[model samples]
Target: MQGYSAASLKPIFDTHIKNDAQVLADGWCGYNPLKEECPNLKQTLSNKGKNFKMLHIQIRDFKNWLRGVHSYCNKEYLQKYIDEYFFRFNRRNHRKINFR
Candidate 1:
């Protein structure tokens, strides 16, 4: 959502998403406009403890592993690290080296 525009979000709402897609996301203010824009939109508060427990378990685990490191240091490389981590998570331990 950082660089996305309202125009960009319209397509997602308009697309033939399966089963009235349940989008799980943090409470970003940009989505405020979506309530008026998308007729079927459902909003969930991500800060709720129970919801965070289920949704962010893996990301919390990753942060826990870096507990000893300074927060600012991790912030510097956060995007790259999260991308690589998610790639491995999706791969399920497969170690192929080909770049797609």
Candidate 2:
């Protein structure tokens, strides 16, 4: 695993997010490379009101959803479970498009 190394973040920065987008992250050595990669990168210390608030909220919700709905997941199939959740989460606004 790359585990927060500069090498690990290169491709994600290169491919996933656009250069114009702002990259907000907590102060971690792993994210240090982002400064060089992104023009709008903002790395803040892990203090109150400094962290990415909504991102942290979403992460908390995901963990709660996993613990509450799945109870316990096997390591072998955890990726599948997370994928399923994202599938539902991504299309959550289209409840009555065709039906209505």
Clashes of 2: 0
Clashing pairs in 2: none
Best by lDDT: 2
lDDT of 2 by residue, 11-90 (tens): 88888989888887777787776777587888788687436677778778889999999999999999998898888788
Question: Model 1, which residues run further than 4 Å from truth?
Answer: 1-20, 25-29, 66-76, 93-100
* Model 2 segments more than 4 A misplaced: 48-50, 98-100
Cα lDDT of candidate 2 equals 0.80
lDDT score for residue 62 of model 2? 86
If candidate 2 were superposed on the true structure by all CA atoms, what would the RMSD be? Answer: 2.2
Strongest candidate by TM-score? 2
Per-residue alpha-carbon lDDT of candidate 1 for residues 1-100, written as tens digits (9 for 90 to 100)? 3466656665676675443556555566666676664445565676556666855788686776456443544577878777766776678656565454
Task: Score each candidate by Cα lDDT.
Answer: 0.62, 0.80
